[model samples]
Target: MLPRPVVPAAATTGALLLLAACAPTVPVTAAPYATDPVCAAVVLATPDSLGDGLDRVATDAQATTAWGEPRDAVVLRCGVEPLGPTTERCESVTTPNGPTIDWVIVEDDGDWTFTTYGREPAVQLLVPGAVAESRSTSFVDALGPAVARTEQLRQCL
Candidate 1:
């Protein structure tokens, strides 16, 4: 009986990496959606340079998109019915490029849900509380234009 020689682990790992890089693109199914289809186009047309730590994800809905991992993700839902008059902490932010977005903050223990305040077919973003406090400005700064394209039927006074 003869024993076989083993290849070095480093070379084996490199081979795996090369194989993975050559793998075919996997299809991501859309999430179940009940909102307007136009919102999907807005989402699909959004650039990938959203931010430093976020990555676009495929869901089953036309009006919904998600970023980051499923466990703790930032979910954006467009074409939602806008919020009516409320007494919550509604804030307006002007992006660096000069677009203003209105948002109503819904705070939970470790999550902050922000919904566009005065836009038709509003946008709702569910971000982790930590990310909301830290990178929210950056995210909103980038997201303003895209969301604004949907048209505003109202404005925060």
Candidate 2:
């Protein structure tokens, strides 16, 4: 009688497929704004806190060119109507690849105070309204914090 052939466990079909399906999936996410608490600190900034020439953050022609032609970076403003003027807290990226700066700007105010997180103690805060808004790294780390803070302040007013 011919010897019976044996099938090895490693040769089993669909084992690889099963393993692939079981592997964890990690969604790709954008990088946070500098990972510094100072950059993330937008709520503390007030109109009174800012000095002169803070409004035109990236407007200088020379600066603009270096920052990729000055694209209209998204600005998250809370505490008041977006277009209408008020003491709304605002945060935006100065340039596409530049640092993310937090600003507390009020209408008719000459001083536009801004803050940027630097390397040091890293403190991460979840924006108050993060769940309601579309989740983005920038929003979660920077925009959300500022907007959430402004919203909180607006509720008081």
lDDT of each: 0.70, 0.29
Question: In model 1, how large is the Cα lDDT of residue 119?
Answer: 75
Whose TM-score is greatest here?
A: 1
The number of the candidate with the highest lDDT is: 1
Off by over 4 Å in 2: 1-69, 82-140, 151-157
Runs in model 1 deviating more than 4 A are: 1-34, 133-137
- State, as a TM-score between 0 and 1, how close model 2 is to the true structure: 0.19
Candidate 2 lDDT, 29-86, residue by residue in tens: 2224333333234423322211121121222111010111113222222222123233
- Least accurate 10 contiguous residues by lDDT in model 2: 60-69
Q: What's the C-alpha lDDT at position 107 in model 2?
A: 24
- Summarize candidate 1's per-residue lDDT along 1-157 as a digit string, tens digits: 8999899999999999998666433233333332566576657655565577677755555567777655566777777667898889988878786678888888899788788887766778778765666675457656777777666777776
RMSD of each: 7.9, 17.8
Please report how far candidate 2 places residue 77 from its true position, in Å: 3.8
